[model samples]
Target: MKIFNVFPETIFSIGPVHITDTVITTWLVMIAIITISYFATRKLSVKPSFFQEIIEAVFEAIEVTIKDILPVEPWLVIPVLGTLWILIGFSNLAGLIPGLKTPTADLNTTFAFALISFSMTHVIGIATQGLKGYLMHYKEPTWLLLPFHLIAEVTRTIALAVRLFGNMLSGDMITIILLGIVGLLVPVPFSLLHIIIALIQAYIFGVLTLVFIAGGIRTKS
Candidate 1:
């Protein structure tokens, strides 16, 4: 599956821990999100700054999505969904920076994100419906379907990871091939299309996470 080293490489290691370019890029993404959010919200004024306005709009959008998706209290998922949207968007677009590869293009990174979504869905499910209640949810119609339900959850998570990873990796490969074959000018449109795809993928990933979370919370057979 390795093509032109489009996959992430171990840039360095500390003691027994090996660090890949994906790790470095993800670190930068997290730091950037935190720093921007902190500074933007630090000074609360009647008339907010551009960053503040943008931040508020982002939060509002996620909040609305949560409200629309969930029947009960939707406050709990807002932060998680917002973070996912912003982080994936950042990671997918990170390739735009010279010398830095997009972390989302790495299967390891995407799988980690998918695992987080899987974990959170169950955690939130249990939170919404106590431990015993959530566990018993699988036995809705009958105990016979428990295994099927569990398998579905796992398969969907894998699909989510692969979907994002495949798209980002293909986009990067195409961009690199174009650049190698025809310098930079021709790839501009493709790069722009890549950006649009990045945003769309981010939106799809976030919405899918929210939908999965909602499914866990709703408690159906």
Candidate 2:
């Protein structure tokens, strides 16, 4: 029997471009993040509000995570990784709302994220170690390993996309099936568990991105 269709349905079109609910939800998520950030930072002062304290804690946590991973100061990479962690976590949890969908459940959305991480990994690598230095890492130990290194990069990016897509897709399907059988109240525990898993996946995705980039920055290993 068919469960959920992996592809999202087209909601509308503009000119020649067709937009899916996935895209719309993603835009909504982006707007929400931007609005919250604007409000959170606009009132900066000597003393922090309660909401500002929570926001500061989130940023501190991201910095600490990056510090634990990359030996560098964590300044350059913080913005990209922190955005990924925040946006992806909120996108995943969007499913908890009654009318909204989780944008990360869509393969296109996750694939786009993986590509961003992949591209930024190389960009930051080059910025840290210059182009020639970054490229030379592929030939480390011997030139014979370069091809294997290339293949690993491509495969890992694909795996990164597929992993998030599979987990969120399966979670959505499970919740739908349970809702069909047991109605609303019974699925509450599972729903909360799903939320926790979503946050975990978001953090894992950011950490994996850092790990991939860390290798590029340091050629020795």
Candidate 3:
């Protein structure tokens, strides 16, 4: 019944540093991604299996989405999109496992992802356009709009974190509560719905990253 207390107590600490359940879940997610990718790409086959086909389809879909968003250098977006898709997709699905918590269910994990996306957006922007150009993006069209642009950037990143964290956490919490209330039978439908939501969240996260990256790459007029 103590849901929020699910995180394990810190086993060790250095100064003010502390580790918890959220950190462990994040490592597990990363490991899952590494294992999947290693096996998926390890054996090069002339004829692909069902799993390979599905994996290929996912990569292809990501490629298409990136191209649609960036047009010119879709490849640049692949590493970010691919990693996010795998990590978030698996984390969301982790709810199906008993006694396991989805990493995204933790605000810290979700915020970390959002921060990475935000940092990458600006880094890519600065790399593509010089530092002067990146800074000038906020000062564009009219000087009066500068504050709005700055606020928009911060708002979007917060929105991204909250949207992902809120959805996954709520879904998992609802499923858990339903299981406790009505036992097993009634939770089935909700579980299926959770699956769909998991996939949708992954897609939304990827698309938003693409959008932010694309926006960053745009030249100011």
Candidate order, lDDT descending: 2, 1, 3
Better of 2 and 3 by lDDT: 2
Better of 1 and 2 by lDDT: 2
Off by over 4 Å in 2: 1-4
Ten-residue region with minimum lDDT total, candidate 2: 1-10
Residue 75 C-alpha lDDT in model 3: 68
Give one digit per residue, the lDDT tens place, for model 1 in 1-221: 12337657888999999999889989998898899888887897889888778878878888888799875578777767678889999999988887778899989999999998898788888888888877877886789999999999999999999999999998989888778788867777897898999999998998888788787667743
Which regions in candidate 3 have their CA more than 4 angstroms from the true location? 1-16
Candidate 3 lDDT score at position 57? 91
lDDT of 2 by residue, 1-221 (tens): 12346788788999899998788878888899999999999998779989989999999999998988885669889988899889999999877777667788899999999999999789888887788888888888889988898899999999999999889888988998888898777678998899899999999899999999888777744
Clash pairs detected, candidate 2: none
Query: In order, what lDDT does every prediction score?
Result: 0.84, 0.87, 0.79
Model 2: number of clashes?
Answer: 0
C-alpha TM-scores of all predictions:
0.91, 0.94, 0.90
For all candidates, the clash counts are: 0, 0, 0
Note the residue pairs that clash in candidate 1. none
